[model samples]
Target: MPLCFQELVTPLLIDGAVSPLSPQSPLSASFTSVLPYHKDSGILSEAEAKKAQKALADGNLLEVVFAAIETLRRVPSTRVNIAVTGDSGNGMSTFINALRGIGHEEEASAPTGVVRTTQTRASYSFSCFPDVVLWDLPGMGATSQSLEDYIVEMQFSQYDLFIIIASEQFSMNHVMLAKAIEEMGKKFYIVWTKLDMDLSTRMLTEGQLMKNIRENILENLQKTRVRKPPIFLISSLEPSWHDFPKLRDTLKEDLSDIRYHGPLQNLFHAYKEIINDKVTYLQEKIATNSFQNTPGMRDIDDLAECLKTYRLSFGVNDESLQQLARSMGKESSEYKAIMKSQDLQAVITRGWKLKCLTCRVMKMFLILLSYIPSLDALIAPYIRQEKHNRMLEGVAEDTMTVLKKVLKDFTSS
Candidate 1:
C-alpha cells in the first residue's frame, strides 16, 4: 500500500498475476493444454486423461504438481504394471512369454500349457520395463467364476493396463470381461491369440478371416459399454509376426502416458488450481481485513520475512534451490541464474527502503492526510492489505515460474 510499492505491484488491486486463470491466459498457454479436458498433447489419450483427471480430483493440488515435477527426474526408475488375463488354455501365459520376448521353455519365461498353467497368479519381469511387472492372473474359468468375483480376485485396480486374451472365438465370457473392464473405467486391450490357426483354416482368405473376427467381436460388444478398444490378433508362438510387434509399439506409446503424459496433464490442471486457490484466499483476506491477524508482518519492510515464508513454502528459497542443485549435480547459480523467484530473496534491503524514503512528497501528503479522522482509520490498513495481496501474488507467480524452469530443464535433459 506504500506509494513506493507501486514499483512492485499494479495500482489496481484486481490486476493480480494469479487470477482464476482462464484457458486463454498467457500463463495457462505456457503449460499443458489438458486441464479441464484432454487435448492431444502428444501424450494423453482419452482413457489416460480420465485417470489423470481422477488423480487430480482425489489429490492435493500442489502436491500433485510437485510430485510430477519430481517424477521427471526418476522416470528411468518409474514402474508400470500390466495384467494379462484370459480363460483357461487361452494362451495368456504364451502371450506373456511372447510379449516379454522370452520363448516358452526358456529361462524366466512364464510357463505355458493347454491346461491352467497359471493356477495361482504368476508375475513376469523383463529388462524391457526395468522395474515393470506383468502379472499372468489365474484364468477366468469357463462358466465357473462370476464377473464380480473375478474382478476382486484379480485386484484389477493395481495394474495400469489389462490384456484380455481370447482365441478361436470371442465368446460370451470374453464380451462380459470387456464390458466389466470398460465399466470399471479401466484401459484394456483385446488380444486374440492363435491367429495363425485362423489363417491356416481352409474356410476363408486371411484378410477376410481377420475382418470376420474383428466384426464378430464388435457385434457381440454392441450392447456393452466397451468402446472401440485396441484389439490385437496375434499368434503367441510367432512373436515377430501379426500384431505382436504392433502391440509392443503400442506399449511403448502408452508406457510414456503411464509415467509422464497423464500425470503431467494432471500437473498442469493442479498447478492452475493451486495458483487460483492462493489468489482467492489472499483476495478474500484483502476483502475481510483478515491479514491483520497475520503475525510478524507489522509493516511493508517486514515483507522480507513474509517473502522468506513464501520462499520456504514454495521450495524456492536459497537453501532449497541450492539443495536441489546439489541433488542434480549442478551449481545453485545454474537454477538461480534463470529464476525470477530470486526476487523474493533480495527483495527487502536498505537500498530499497532508501528509495521508498526518497518518496518524501507522497509521505508528506500521507502525513497531512492522516489528520482526516475516519479516513486515517481506513488509509493505512487498506495500503497494508493491498501490499500483502500483491506480495502474495508476486510470490505465487515466481513459484510457478520456478516450476516451469524445472520442467523445462527436466524435459530437455
Candidate 2:
C-alpha cells in the first residue's frame, strides 16, 4: 500500500519545526496549508497509520525528541554531555571539577568527603558554550548485574571516551570494562589516578608501586585478552603539569580530521573558544572601564580578573603547550599526520608557533638581568639571537625524540 504523505509529513514537519511552537499559536495555520500538497502526494495510507500508532504505543516518540535535543545541545547555548566513570575516590569528579577550573576540594563542590556520592548517572554543566556537562556514573563492582545488561541499561558506549580510573592496582572490573569496550569497539583510557598518594605512602616505594601497577594493568588486559592498551598515571593534586599536557596532546593526536573540522577536543573546545572570544572582548572592556570612575574601574577590573581565571580553567595555556611540544617534539606533528592526515606544513607551522611562543615567554626572565642589566643593547640582541637559535634547535631535537618514542611505543605495544 502507498504511504500517507499527510501523516508522515505531518510528524516530520512537526518534529523538525512546528513542535517548538505553542500548540495554540495561529502559526499552526501554516501546517494546514501543507495538507493540499499532502493530498497531491497521496494524503493517507493504512500501513503508515498502523506503524505510527505502534510507534506511539511503544513511546518511540523520543527518537524524534532526542533528535531535537541533540541538535539543541550542539548549538552554542546548550551543554555538551560528557560522562566520566571509575572506582570510588579515583578522581573522576575531581577531574571534571578541575576541567571547569573549579576548586574540587572546596566546601560545596568538593570532589571528596561526600557520602553516597553519585549513586546514579547525574549531570553537571556550566553556562558556557560547548557548555560543559560532567556526568558521574555509579561506580562499578558494586552492582551484581551482568555486564551486558548493565551496558544496555546505561547506554555506556554513547560517551566520547570511557575513562577507566584506578589508584594502586587495576581490578577485574577494569579488565571487564576494557573487554566490554573492546568487544563494542569503544574508545577508552586507563587513568591511574592518585599518584601523589602512592608517592607519599610509607607502605610502598613509589617507583616499585608504579611498576607493579603497570604490570598488573597489563596482566589484567592479558586476562581479558585485549591486544593493545594505553595507560597513564595522573595526580589530581598538582598533576604532573607535564603529564596532563601529554594526555591532552594524546587526545588531539587520536581524533580524526573530521572531528577537527568542527570544534575539536570534545565539547569543551566549543566552550573554550567561546570563552576566548569573550575574554578578548572583556579585556577591551576593562581598558575602557579603566578610563571611567575609579570605583567603577575597580569593579570592572575585578570582573575582568574573574573572567580571566575562568578562561584559564580549561587547561589551555602557552606554558603547557610549550612543555608538551618540547616533550613531544616532532612526533607530535607526525602523530597529527597519522591521525588526521595533516600536511607537513601544518606540522611545521605548529612547531614554529610553539617555538616562538616559548622564546617570547622566556624573554620575560631576561628582565631580572636588568639589575646588572650590564649587557649592552648589542649584547642583548646577540643573546636574543643565540636564544632563538637554541630554541629552534631544541624543538628539532625534541621533535625527533618524540617521533621515535611514539613509533617505538606504537610498534612495541
Q: Could you say which candidate leads in lDDT? A: 1
- lDDT comparing candidate 1 with the true structure: 0.63
Q: Quantify how close model 2 is to the true structure by its C-alpha RMSD in Å.
A: 24.8
For model 1, how does the per-residue alpha-carbon lDDT over 1-413 read when each residue is reduced to its tens digit?
Answer: 10110111111222123222111222222222333554542333455444434333332223333445544544454577889887787889888877777678788888877666777788888654666789999878844668898888888878888898999878787888888888877788999989998888758988888888888888888867469889888998787788877887777666655655555555555555545554565467556765444543344446566655555544466766665555444677876766554654434232344235325675686688788978877776666565555555665666666556555445433
* Alpha-carbon shift of residue 255 in model 2 (angstroms): 5.7
Using alpha carbons, what is the TM-score of model 2?
0.41
TM-score of each: 0.53, 0.41
TM-score, model 1 to reference: 0.53
Clashing pairs in model 1, backbone N/Cα/C closer than 3 A: none
lDDT of each: 0.63, 0.44
Residue ranges of candidate 2 with Cα displaced over 4 Å: 1-81, 105-111, 126-132, 202-208, 240-242, 252-413
Candidate 2, residue 250: the lDDT equals 59
Tens digit of per-residue lDDT, candidate 2, span 254-322: 432213223222322322222233334333433343323332233322333322222122111223223
Best by TM-score: 1
